[model samples]
Target: MVNITKDTEKEELIAQFWPQISRAAAGYENRPALSDELAQEMALSVWRSLEGFNDQCSLSTYIYRVIHNTAIDHIRRHSKISEDELDEAMLCESPTPEKNTLQAQRQKQLIVAVNQLPLSLRQVMLLKLEDLNNIEMSEVLGISEANVGVRLHRAKEQLSKLLAGMN
Candidate 1:
């Protein structure tokens, strides 16, 4: 059927997109271990949706959209736990002193705080921290430059509050 041919073509396109997808994903360190899985999912989504792409945007832009959305989806799905629960779980685990338990606790707090942010604000923060410039971020998030600024501002404020409470 036509679907089979299209699926095969999509698989080939995913192969082409893999390297850049992984590179783009590298800058997200909050959950570094999920990078490979997230990148592959993004690449496959872009490939499957390629036929419907209107060419209104650059291929890079389209790919970025796919990756950004996938990352946001991952974050939202994993953000359900309360900070208290996270802290309790971490405390229960026994880590070596060389592992710097305090530093690990702080990092966990940071991630939990980020998770508490609204999805739009969280996405902006993550993309910005990943070092994507305004234009690149706009392309990736499918948002206006001005909106990205607003979201980043709100996200920073929320993160500061969360961090302050964590100490």
Candidate 2:
């Protein structure tokens, strides 16, 4: 809720973008404590970077770029992600507890596999999970749309292999 500028407040930005920030952070670090710490760091980075934001890209795009950069910095500092399950509440509610349990297991497995990807492919997959179009991902990652497409394709292939080996 700290004031960033007369026009916009940090709290307002956090409220609007916290989900994306959290998801991006979790993509980098799975352990709950570390992921939460990364999310806070990303929010602070976004708050600090807000003043520099121009209309060159959408606010979502700007927010994503800041968070991803924060995540990369976090990875460099921390150097590893310990295995952990995602919060169950983050998963869809199934008709039964058994189905929900199974779904959660699969999701956890998928996340673990994703965490094993090379950084370049991991970045694209995480952005893709956030539903970014290739163009948006390109702008956020400062790569070409074609590169995004290639990475996404490779990520999907690799994830399939990783998940298969998990079973």
In angstroms, the error of model 2 at 9 is: 3.0
In candidate 1 the C-alpha lDDT for residue 96 amounts to 72
Candidate 2 stretches with Cα past 4 Å from truth are 1-4, 82-100
Q: Give the per-residue lDDT digits (tens) of candidate 2, residues 1-167.
A: 22246445767888899998888887888777789999999999998888787778888898899999999999999866433344443343345676558787797787778888999999999999999999999999999999999999999999999999989
Question: What's the count of clashing pairs in each model shown?
Answer: 0, 0
lDDT of each: 0.69, 0.84
The TM-scores of all predictions, comma-separated, are 0.60, 0.85
- Compose the digit string of candidate 1's lDDT tens values, residues 22-112: 7555433234456577676677678766776676666656767887777667656664446566566557756777447677767667666
Clashes of 1: 0
For model 1, the superposed segments whose C-alpha errors exceed 4 Å read 1-40, 46-60, 71-79, 83-105
Cα deviation at 63, candidate 1, in Å, is: 2.8
